[model samples]
Target: ADLPTALRLRRGAQALGGMLGPGLCGVVLAGAGLRAAMVMSLFLFGLATLAAWRVGSAQRPAETTARRGWFDEMADGLRAKWRVRLDRWWTLVGALMMMCLLPATGLLLPLRIQGLGLSAAWFGACSAAMSLGLLAGVAGLAPALIERVGRVRALAVAVQACAVAIAGIGLVRWAPGLVALFAVIGLALAVTQLVGQTHRMLAMPDDYRSRMSSAHLAIAHLAAALAPALGGALLGVATVPTGYLLLGAGFAASGLLLMAVPGLALFLRQDHEGARGWYDRHYPQAFTRS
Candidate 1:
């Protein structure tokens, strides 16, 4: 189930890394001189566009024997499984967890350069360098970590790392430390994103993969949309660092949420037969009610 989707997810991770490299370099060069930045940004933007197109084109999934018309196929897939105690409830719980974390990450974006008192050019350089770190984390670190630790453990660790980095963002009392901290924050953000998405993909059922991805994306964007405005509002009531601290706290709490939620192994699709037999013997009436 969702073998195609797994391939697409891997490709998407690569494409995102490709865009981040040049796009950020251009942003930095622009700060050096407007004309230079503009030329570089344009060139990088063109490269990114091509990379995105390639990723999109590669997503045409090959049909398989189990494939059927989309809607009917999804319905049948859903019916074939024993509904776990938590499967239907997962959407809401997962979305709320992402909402807490994504906004906290987004809140760092605007404040990153300004808080450091660095030239926009330096910030751009960090962006480009950070992309390289992101690529390393995505392509080199992710597979080994996920395989060794399992999806839930990997994701929780990523979130905890992000929370620590977010708190580090508040330590930018000096310019030099701030620049270094921003790079670390960017690194943590990339790793967290990769691990989180992989966990989500592996946790969901095959037929609901796309819908699950959509739900994850929608909540993430909603968090991004609100973070800056909400962070700004908090700033009005407190210091800028205080606002960042609050956002960091939110992300740390999210690590707790992910840890608190039952592990994915408990809901493994392979366990459905055992679950069905248990339901038949112990909770037949409730099974029918569902």
Candidate 2:
């Protein structure tokens, strides 16, 4: 119940930042110059740093009697995640989704726009559209949609939507069509993210949550790092549309594979009490520190 609200607030802030940051940077660049725009960015970064420092100072640090080494902690986190069937499945799903989709938005989209002979302003508009879509999805649309369709079904539908949008981005020549596709991609991405994050928050024990999050981030980052090079290689061998089609197919396949996994629906549908029961039944040592 609370998870949805928390995720909405968090993702909303991120979406707003995404929407505003580029537009502000563009305005600064156009009015002042590249260097001035960069300086403004640095100033904003400093403000963010100060805000973080203030927040950190206000919070009391956790009391720990014994601290493990960083590597040991990370290894333990990975081991715990792998030991749980649900965690393992979702982690892999998240990583693969990142690999397939990141390149489409981050690398290929701009190139596709360029191929259409569109200006940078068009790309900016598409970006803002994506951000607005994400904001709309997370703020109200995702929760209601998830409730109506169910978690697993909603996720499946969102993944398929992303696949279609990405493929359309490659094939669509009109600038408006590209913006619409990017908006669809953003909305779908938001749904997937909300579902994944809510599961993470509810499924893991309190002691394990941060560790599991770190482990997940590491894997996702690795997949994302490799995605750009793979995308570039694909572009080298094929046209932009062909690359998008292949990537979209991979994204769709990932959803199908996830759906095929045993126990996934049950795992995602679990509530807080149900999730706790699941952990107890499946991994009795989940809460026990080694």
Candidate 3:
């Protein structure tokens, strides 16, 4: 319950930043020039860094009797994550999800807009629509919707929603249609992300949380890194619409695969105590002996 709220607040802040950062840069560019805008961005980055440093300095470091090399620690994290069946399945599904979708927003969208003979301003409008949808999802819609549906079910629904939106994007050439599809994509992405985070918080033990998160991030980044090349290769051979259709099909397949994960739906549907009991019974090794 509280976890969802916390995630909402955190993601909401990020969504707002995504929406406002470009607008601020545009304002600076209009008022002064490109160089001024660049300088302003650097200044804002420095301020963010300083704030992060201050926050970190205020926290006490954890004390450990035994220290290990970074490589050894990373290996331990990977081992821990792989040992748990649920974690392993979730990580793979998350990676596939990222690979199937990241390229649509990062590379293909711009190309599709350009192919449609739309202006840069139209692209900006689509981007804003996405941000607004993201904000709406994180702030309110996701939590309420996820409460009504189990986390795993919500994730499945969100992924399918994203697939529909992506497929719609391929089929529609109108500017308004594109913008609406982008917004739906954004909302679905937010729900998927929120569910992923909430699952981690609920399922991972305290000792493994940070390590497992790092491992997940590494795998997700690797998948994301490969996504652009995959998108580019598709676009090189097929048209943009074809690329979108193929990606949407792949995404839909991933969602179907998620439904087949053993015991995941039951686990996610349980209360906190029930979930912990289920985890302990099914995956005893996931918990540290101490």
User: RMSD to native for every prediction?
Assistant: 6.9, 2.1, 2.3
Candidate order by decreasing lDDT: 2, 3, 1
Give the per-residue lDDT of model 1 (tens digit) for 53-104.
8874445444542455766544433432225334334444444545544444
Best by lDDT: 2
Report the alpha-carbon TM-score of model 1 versus the true structure: 0.63
Per-residue lDDT tens digits for candidate 2, residues 123-173, read 888888889889989888887788898888889999999999988888888
lDDT of 1 at 139: 56
Going through the candidates in order, what is the number of backbone clashes in each?
Answer: 1, 0, 0
Using TM-score as the measure, which candidate wins? 2
What tens digits encode model 3's per-residue C-alpha lDDT throughout 192-260?
878767656667765566677788889989999999999989989999999999899988998888777
TM-score attained by model 2: 0.93
Give lDDT per model, in order. Answer: 0.53, 0.82, 0.79
Q: What is the descending TM-score order?
A: 2, 3, 1
List TM-score per model, in order.
0.63, 0.93, 0.91
How many clashing pairs does model 2 include?
A: 0
For model 3, the superposed segments whose C-alpha errors exceed 4 Å read 1-3, 57-66, 276-281, 287-290
